[model samples]
Target chain A: MSRTNPNAIRSNRTANFLIYALCGIIAFVTVYPFLYMLSMSISSPDEVVKKTIVLLPKGLSFLSYELIVQNTQMWRAFGNSVLYTAAGTLSNIVMSLLIAYPLAKPKLVARRFFTVFLIVPMYFTGGLIPSFILMHTLGLYNNIWAVIIPSMASIWNIIIARTFIKSLPYSLQESALVDGASEFRILFQIIVPLSKPVMAVIGLYTAVGIWNDWFTALLYLPNSNLHPLQMFIARLLVFNYSSIDPGSRLKLDSAVTQTGVITQMKYSVVMVTTLPILLLYPFLQKYFVKGVMIGSLKE
Target chain B: MEQVVVQTKPKAGRIRSFLRELKRDRQLLVLMLPAVLHVLIFCYIPIYGITIAFRNYRIGDPYFALGAAARWIGVQNFLDFFKSIYFSRLVTNTLLLNVLTLVFTFWVPIAFALLLNEIASKRYKRVVQSFSYLPYFVSAVIIVSITLNILSPDGVINNAIQALGGRSTYFIGKAVYFRPIYILLNVWKTFGWNAIIYLAAIAGVQQDLYSAARVDGANRWQQMSYITLPSIMPTIILLLILNVGTLFASNTELILLIANPNNMDVSDVIGTYVYRMGVVEGRFPYATAVGFFAAVANFILLWTVNYVVRKKTDEGLW
Candidate 1:
């Protein structure tokens, strides 16, 4: 690519090396925190507080993991998170498909009105206060349905689906209609089967979103039993510090010893909550990039 | 032209055409009904929910009866919010955070995209890109927890500071450190993911332009400045214009986690403020009023900035 500029090649080579070095350092900075957190979780509680552990654990211990296992709330929150992500993503894809199919059809009547109706929510909303009141009025507050229903349909997903479906040649659907297939049959058997790629991308994206959301649980569900995994992890890390027992307090008199058990416990919890999603990340990554590219293509 | 077309058509003929199209697409329209109803109840009803900002809303009042029993005091809620002592503080803090975010965080991704584009090895580039994109998927709770661990008095960051002969301080609790820490973490979290869009734009640039520049004896930096940067300017401007709308927006979780009572003066923005007022204190009307004003300002700024960008560069989000 650079053969035309022979005289400048040497200087460009040096610049390229610098760019590689800089990006390498940035990648290190990005991954170092999680590695350190993992190291802390596995290291002995004493070593974690004394700051002896950096990239590797000084002494292995499963005490934090044992504590997490003994806690029932942790398991309950995990179940809630799984339920929300699985059910929420299914609803989102179905709802998005229903809306996107009609909007994608050129022969559909009132297309302008329907498209604008869907697009308006992207710009403005009722604001937080009124949204809360509306939820409360609907009897959704403190119910599991609160987390599921409001987020059921995403307009951006609809747009992406519409674009993907519209990109297909019109004759594909026309032939299906010529075969005496009804619109419903064509949508389910033909358009949907052909939409697997977009559907998978949107599904993975929405699942990641629902899995990581803590604010909805914080606002709608005041009951501790109903809290999601994220909310539970947040409480342990931020709000529960004062609840350490007197026996632990005696050991915490030293500056290094003060944060021994709870700090390690928090690290372990972070690993537990994020490890599943991180494991699923590589599979979703290619589709994630494709989803963004599909979104950015001009209408 | 549309009006002229409509005027030329007979009324019965226009109705007949409409009925024909509707009958042809009835199944498709029927499939859209449930989604439309969902949006109507979930999204559109919330638009009418803003009326609670004007009324003295109570918990027991039925939603529809808000107009009748919940005494309408015509902007009194808004007046109280504007007259409150924290009004300017909230406004200033919100604007300061947004401008600081734009100045510090916006360009990092563009630069990252350009640097990545310059890398010679595709394998090495993929490794670094994947690592950088990892944090954007991490939850905010986990990110803040990591920050809390690393920035603690005896944590890695302060340990390094101590090695350099500086005393350790509680970083999260300090009002002065709030903005820098917030902006820095946000930059780290978003820069890689945001760069994907710019990378896409760069990929779309015509290869012939670069070839032409190379043939003209332009060096690498010169070619980048003249060819690549000019090509991606529209994408950059479009994103910038969109970002201008969120100048008043702040992430509530990030602020809520990092802020203590000690640092509230600097860390408290409109989102967190409304959350505390409405949920914790049950001041629904007042919170609604303050939030509505902020949202209206945001919407107006979105259109105004988009209009200005369109006028100057002939590119806007219509």
Candidate 2:
């Protein structure tokens, strides 16, 4: 067919139009829930109860934010989540880098054995009951370590890091070794300095994972105070606020106002727990895609 | 004498070289200590504790301690699990839920990626792609929360229905709606994120193939089917095998959040069953046995699929 043939041009236009329409619809569907939640959270309680707020806020009010601010448990859980994400991500990066660095080296003895050792956990686990039993036996139950230690090293992350490190020129390490640098010095001073991209990828992934996790918290940490923000949000949204303290409940003069406040607060809870990651998503996206690509292209 | 010397010389040299490598890389081994210990203490120890499935384990019984109360019970726990009222229901629920979810959600990302790859405008494609990834970053709690609110009796969907002179359907409170809601939510949360891999795969397809196809009078659809799809077939097959491997492993976190008494008949799976029996009811041995059975089945399924795929085609995870 000629480049400017009318029929061909028209067909191309038709295909492009269809692609745009489908892409737009899928994007809207993906984003609609978040938009709906934001609109509901800010919309006036009366309007919310009337079911008038669908996609946009009407008679905007910050009442839910005010109530969430006053809820001490929410704040505590938020603080705990922040702490866990920070500590857990650090531990994950350290452990992953340590193992990955050694495994990346061709000179490492028993490289294949170590690779299989790490990969085995990905395919099989001891199941929930035995892990839980082990947690109690180790005195990690109801403690912060229970949240951090079990997830200290992900085999997938280690593999990603190892792949990246292997891609780095082997000559750099060789030169450093020739200059009388120890392996530890070479790894920490040379490799780690040049590994910012992989570090960022692993860091963002670990932070998001630690932030979003609630199941681990639920299993090991029976203490409500130790619960993370996601766990708190889960209790509010799923359990109907049954575990919420009575004092934290919105004290209103009428039951109607109280229920309206509670309903909006649920939306607010969802937003508060999720907004940080969503806001950081644009920056997180590149590294995450990079991480997944690296992981998928494994040797 | 010559035969003995030939065999012994290589064996001795191999051991000597291994020892030399270890001595030279002692610092690297030291660096590996933390991770090695972390795996040994956390992973392998728990693996060793799988023996609890055979014991009459209770809440405070010492793990692996051969006491009178926690003595060996052989496969009694497994037998009890097999004979239990929930045995069939749990297996059916787990398998059916996963199969339905796979059927409904698996093809979506592939279609999305194909459509996305055809877009003429790069800027618009980027914007749409960014929007699609938003839900993936959201937590399961938030996803379940949004689903519950939208499908609640007084929530938006019912409200929309009621405004249209229709009666409100208690979507969340009905057993029939659980699988649909769960599967749809999975699609919503995962489709865009999952598309990234396919998009990457699509990007790797040779531009020469498309050019040649177009030169031969192949239209856009023809090029997609003959060129793009064939190039990404390996990725598709690999992902399908991996998805099938998890046939018994339902999303326990989401299920626990959404499941209630009203929907328990449909929502109960091996995961939730183990959690309730072990953690809530303290039936450690029984729950352990049930979980072990599920894990073994999953591993076997994965192995069989991989073996068959490798035999039929040259693609396998191993």
Candidate 3:
């Protein structure tokens, strides 16, 4: 039964209007900066840094984006980022499905031990240093495997996927078993199709995790050439924008670089890198909005 | 803490029961094999590396790989950190950052989700949610840069300040404004998406409670204050406890993106400090020690909260 009350559904149109109007303003406040960044990147840098410009571009120019694209390091980073996201997502899905399918069966041996091992890391880790040193000792350092492998499996995603798969009737699996279908065959052919909704959500989560990941790259990846797009642009914005402190011609130049122009480029880098996720969001929108009720708390 | 509770595993069977269960359902065990390997190799493998936090660790020259030859510092690295100047500053900044963000980013979304739940128009709610959710998908790089522009000395906010016959101030450069901007940016980035969970909780709230409240002569605000708020209390409490459980985990990206040496006094939290000292500067053992100490503090907070929660409510995190 749906939880909403019939009696509580009164036609308070005026209150609804007021609430919605406030929501609109809040949404505008939220979306405005990203929009400003987009418009500014296409606008000439000189027009962008004007003290009083908020709405409407002073004049349009693509020189900012042109500079970002031509940087070559940005493109290299983009290639690295795409590689990282792809390999990482593929690994997450494989690991998640592999773990989840078995956990969902309810009759598996040592399921509890595996579950604890899977979920404990979700709460705490040895922090960054130990993990970095571990990766280094494994000889994955400076290699793309360092970025792609450690994040291949997430215990939290496994548990969620397992929980979701568990909710499916065991009869489906049982029926397949009776039909003499192998367990691997059933999981691949039957369970995978039924579990599309959760898979989509987990896929989106893994993709976003990899796409936004810079810390891992920063730790294991010392080579600038191997830097992911987000890190490369992030370094430029965070490092270069403040390269000169203030009060000289050099200060003016740093300020010029630090202007809405540079940060806007950073925003542009964000836009370009995150575009795949943002675009894929609509397809996942139907399935990806998960309720926290199940895995939220028990202790 | 949240995860430790949900161990969805079958009980161990005696030898007879094991053979009986396995013979009866060999297919299921076969299906579960891949996940077992994934966790054993990926999750547990790295956990063996926690020992590096104990040893005098360096990158490729790992402590564990050396076996008996490994240099054992016993708690020396941790002792060195406590003796150092920046320990308390790191602890305070990390806790304060978490507290402030847990207040702002966590609660605002709960409120927004409640408000969004009240919307009768599904289409309108969808649009607003999509708009808000858009920013979460945006990287930290974008969010910080965008905020820097809007808050910069000659940017929109400061330009407005100048128009009012006031001097423009450097918002980012000033350490005082750091926490507010950090929390505010977090709210802006996460509030909408976070609200979705509370909306889900509110959705699960039975219609009967609202009807009962209305019959008892409740108005909208009263119904909200009593029925709605109380209905969502479990979710709220659960989330609150979960947030408190990890009270020391700071957003390294937010701090790192915004922090310069100038604002280090205020902005340097546990995460950023460790990153700067250990990863960025390569003081492997010293940084590893402090980081391990911070992790232990987090674990203690997690266990303490879980114990208190269990004793008080019988709903322990584990």
Candidate 4:
């Protein structure tokens, strides 16, 4: 309803202004870091060393990006991250769908028992040490399987997928059953095609999770060759930055010391590791949001 | 004889029905096989492996060879942890870090969602919400790196401080700034993502109620306080309970990345301690004991909070 009274309009205007101002400030705080990092990464080493660049680039340079491109180790880690994310997400989706489809069916015997069986791990675990020990015992240590297999299924995602499947017209499955379609056939041919939205939600979740994970690599993949892009970035940005003397590294050019290049590389590495997900985020934001919404509709 | 016949008949029928159900759902069971086997190997085995806390377990020892092969220590690890010099400090640090984070960061998303709901323009609201979620998608490594860069002695914050005629402070190097920096980072990363749920809850609020409130001459603040806030209270309480349940857990990864010798006293939490002890130092049994204690504490806190919430308001995670 429209209000014509001066006081009503004045108060509404005040409230609207306050809300926009607050939200704008919050949004700026959230986004300003990425902007700063981007600007810092591209800024000249001189400006970077002087700490002159804050919100915008000065004497913009592509030197760090150039160095990062030529860095074979970073590229290898990038390749590893891609492979792990693809394998992990595929496994996650397959296993989640497999378990969720059965759980979705009311006619499936002991569905409640199976659901509880899966969910109990969410509440309690053997903690990190035992899991580490178990990994070594299973001979997954220093192997890529260590990273991909353990996180293949998440009960939360399974529940979300199951909830989506349960909401579909049961008659579709019923007719397929009458047509003598096996449960596997119905899951693959009938349920999966209709369940693309939920699959997207879970797939994106798993992909992002695998993409961002470094602790798994740190714990299990002691082999530096198997490190993901995140672990590589972490090494450059967090672990070795302070301990190792940057000046000792081979210099790219005389314009900047190894120290300055290393600083710029730190920002560049973060962008490199982060850019893929951030680039895909807008296109996939809805599915991510849908995942959360579906999860909230708890079983 | 009649009673025996009655009992035996139902038992026999139940067994037959169970077997028939199993046969009919065999395909579904087959589908569930991979996940079931995965969990048994990865999850349940580790759970059984938790028994190492009670054994005199060492690195390279046979983990599963229990009884005579692995010496039984009978809660010695637990006793050692309790009696250690670091016990009180670790407990304090973990609780303080989490409780402080909970206090400072929990209300941010709720406030953000409420304010966004108040915005008249849907387009502006959408843009603001989208920007808010950017940091949440970024890896913790990146976030910590950014934090370090901004807080470094020669970084932006210190530069600003010097420009403003103040002495530059090594923020990360000091124990005092750890909590605020961590809490701020958590708020920045989570506020937008967490707001999605509250926004969803707010969306479910009946539009008719708002219209009615308007007709009754209720102001915006009054409507929010009287109608909107109460409508989303269940969601708010449910989330709060969940947050309380995780009070014993810290952002171990972030802590590990950020903590240094300078701030170790204040920054060392149970997760970091366990990581250092078990993984780094190879004190597997000791670290496992510490982790198990934390896990039990977390479980108890979650259940207690859930129980208390259900008692008071009939809202809980369960």
Candidate 5:
């Protein structure tokens, strides 16, 4: 295809330039806040107070980092987040696999029953109060199990995992069955090994979800010591300066050393909580796209 | 939708066949036991607990016994919610917030995808895509913190405005700005990740259509309008239907984190209301009633949206 008009070609080039520029600006807007946060976190407290540090750190200091590192409760929260994420993701994968595999088999008995049973709840929930009451009744309230047990199996993940398993060639499982392998062996030895990519996809989703979860801790873990990294960060943000009433927020700015330390501390916590996921994203980005496609695309 | 047809024999022999099948797939049954039990206890039991809405559920009520020792007062809690001072405000705020997001953000990803499709350089596209997708991985707490920091009286936005000879504004604390800021952040976090679906759909469009359009003297815009947009309409409609299913559901965590007492007038949604009333204030029965009403509305919305989409476009979540 050739453009006959030089004027039209020039106009098309302009349009292309505009599109690229818009995209670039949007990308910058998406990333600039984190960069600003990073710059503020590293800047000297005096510089932070006296000047508006936009793009770069002025009088860079590790003072905020030093303070964060010295806090044992912060470290404990980080450790708790790791513990929950690891255990929660493993449970999610296993439970999802257990349910998804059988459901993916067209020959399984009560498959339709199980499907409806699970899918209905995806659209309707017991609501927050009922779930809270249920947690209390089950002796999970204010306990770590409150975070882990209720989320052990996500129906959406199960559906995607089931779809992935269903798309795998039936012949693989059929041939294993013909060899007198038990159902468990077929799942472990055949399906599990073959479904590694989907497993990775769901695993990544579950890990990220668990890692990012603050609501669970906020609602369930009223005890401060049990708070995960996200909950701790949320607490710090809202209660950063004792009160966010306009008068106090203004006054708190002048009392920078006493209260404004929280502003820098907030940025440090944001980075610490977010950095691992951000750092891991590039490596897992391909799988993220794959997971979304697998979940959304119709068979 | 594809139906899984399980062949059956006579009705009288169904139980016998099921038993035989169960025995044959005992290992499968064993594997499903734990998950089934977990779902039953955690998911179904809480669903069963919804009955508390009709009863004055006390703290020490027997866990398994429905309304035991607590007098049943059907519809009183619901009536209380309907008559409460905050009722209309909560509903309005919840619906307005979600509808605003739906209206403003629903097509942004499609537009982003279309723009991304125009890029000639693959490497540049990938870099931009990665950077845009970065915010999706950041949690709600950090995103809200970032928002609050930016819109804080002395934050960057205010600082920039001051530089431009404007007065500083406390955007976050103001009720008027809550919905816009919330919608903006929602779109900012999601557009890139959501665009990937449309991007995948656009990639599937036949290359010959573009070539044919180009030969017909069509420009890039004409080619996109004629070919790419039409090809991705089904995916777009499907996603739209799914979004509408949650028309009453606001981003609970985001709202809860971003909203202060001052901004509560605009930011209080059904989700946050439930959290405040149920978890914070310990109004179990009343909160459960409100939540039940929300659940019913959400389910009806989901069903209606799915039905309409299926009828009109033959694209829907089944």
Candidate 6:
């Protein structure tokens, strides 16, 4: 692949540089919004609204952070989100492992029927209304379990766990059976210990889904005080939108005065709601990628 | 696809042997029950709600079948949806948005995987890969909030646009720019993350092909064109078909967060529309009608895609 023409060679190099530079520029643009949010969160709200800001903060202040952290509602939402995510992930893993262990073996009756039955729902859903109504019927409405219970067993995770379990050395389980070990003991002692990586993957996916789940909480946990961080942030954004309505200036100011949290303050609170997630991926990046790789083709 | 020929003749196993097997596999059932129940309660039970699509659904009232309340308007809800003035707009916008997203978010990740696979510098690749993958972890709430900050008139992005001697644009307010911006953000957040799958697929491609091609004096271009792309094509097509299955089921959170009344004409997808109908208006029956309609549409699309893929590629989600 030798270049026959000098002009072509020069043009190719320029094109290559331009392409890489353009990709770099696109990456910058993609990341800039988050960077802007970080800067706004640290800036004085007054300076932020003037629309005269630059790459750097005019004056660094953590008023929004301080306010959001100290706000009892924010903490409550944070606590609820954590409780939901942890509980949801744990429950999902336990349930998925339970299903996978049986399915991984070839001996179950109605094996194909049950497997297909389980997989079908992952591809389709009951939609929003009935699911909401179902929660109400199940006595989960406005309860913390509203978020956790509905999503306890995930078909995708179960399939992934089953696939991994199927890939395991069967002789180990067979030998355990030969040694007169009970099924429960083998599962707890051997399979569970061996499934850490996939488990981490399942836990990561479930945790993220739960952590970012405002919709479930939005529907089931209607209590504003019991709202997860996402729901709370959504309310704040809506509150900001109303305040920023380009109606009478006096009305806008009055709305702002009533809410007390400025628009920029809402942006900062977004950071607070998101900071945990940002901190999460860098650690689970390994397990996360592996899980995606393992589970990506499941569909 | 040729269905797995599940021979129903329970290949005569001695009761003693099956008992041995079941006793052997009883551990399996114990392990599976919790997961099966989780899906049973959360996923399958809710599927019972699909009946509401055919019924005159009420929140607390007794259910009636297939338009029984209004004299069995068979396929009328779907007909109404088709006749609705917004139908064309909804379909067009959803397809446009998905196609654009497929180009950037879906395809670029596959290409990224190919490129990342080629790089000789492992350290550079690792660092870039790590940074690229970081965006997917950021919650939609934060992603949209951050985008809102940038898109707001007095926000830094607007300021930058204004400083460029251009009129400050209200990015979200314009219906025209909504799809582009939505696709852009989606691609930004997902492409690198989505690359993980393709990266895995490419890694799993048989290395013997590469060595043989190189032995034949094939350059990187030829090697990639002949070897890598073909090897990962199945994965690409599989994912493409899956994405198509959900073309109508847009991410409600992203759509809801980014949508304002100004852009509703362009941004209103079935998912967000359902939420707005039920959650916002509390029109339970009507929203139920719409939700079930969307679910049916999704199911049809999925089945159609699977049928086509199975017929064409002999590989599909069965």
**Interface RMSD for candidate 2 relative to the native interface:** 1.3
Pick by TM-score: 2 or 5, better one: 2
C-alpha lDDT of all candidate models, in order? 0.86, 0.88, 0.74, 0.87, 0.84, 0.74
Q: Which digits, one per residue and each the tens of the lDDT, describe model 1 over residues A168-225?
A: 8889889989988898888898889899999998898899889999899989998988
DockQ comparison, 1 vs 5, better candidate: 5
Name the TM-score of candidate 1: 0.94
Best by DockQ: 2
- Pairs of residues at least 3 apart in sequence or in different chains that clash in candidate 2: none
Candidate 5 lDDT over residue span B103-134, tens digit each: 87888989999999999999989999998888
Model 3: per-residue Cα lDDT over A1-299, one tens digit each = 12255544543556677899988988898778767766666665666666334766667766556556666677788899989988888878877887688877776766666667666777657677766666766788888888888778877778778888888999998898899998788889999999887777788888887888777776788888898977786676656632212223223444555575664565466567666766787864555566244345212
- In model 4, which runs have C-alpha deviations exceeding 4 angstroms? A1-5, A241-262, B1-9
**Model 6 C-alpha lDDT per residue in residues A45-123, reported as the tens digit of each score:** 5666564456566677665565556567777888988888888899888888877887888667657788788767877
What DockQ do you compute for every candidate structure? 0.64, 0.76, 0.41, 0.67, 0.64, 0.49
| B124-241: candidate 1 lDDT, tens digit per residue | 9999999988999999889988998799888888898888899998897788989898898899899999999999999999999978887877777997899889999999998998
| Alpha carbon lDDT at A58, candidate 2 | 89
B1-318, model 2: which lDDT tens digit per residue?
844764767887978877998999899999889988988877887887889999977777888675565688899999999999999999999999999999978999999999999997899999999998888888898889899889989888988999999999999889999999999999999998999999999999989998888888888889899999999999998999999889988688889998999999999999999999998898888889999999998889988999999999989888
The alpha-carbon interface RMSD of model 1 comes to 2.0
TM-score (chain A only) of candidate 5:
0.90
What local lDDT does model 5 show for residue A184? Answer: 90
Interface RMSD of each: 2.0, 1.3, 4.4, 1.9, 1.6, 2.7
Residue B170 displacement in candidate 5 (angstroms): 1.6
CA lDDT, candidate 2, residue A111: 88
Candidate 6 regions exceeding 4 Å error are: A1-23, A43-53, A56-59, A238-264, A296-299, B1-28, B62-76, B206-222, B282-285, B305-318
TM-score of chain A of each: 0.89, 0.93, 0.81, 0.91, 0.90, 0.87
For each candidate in turn, the TM-score is: 0.94, 0.95, 0.86, 0.95, 0.93, 0.86
User: Relative to the unseen true structure, what is the C-alpha lDDT of residue A87 in candidate 5, on a scale of 0 to 100?
Assistant: 88
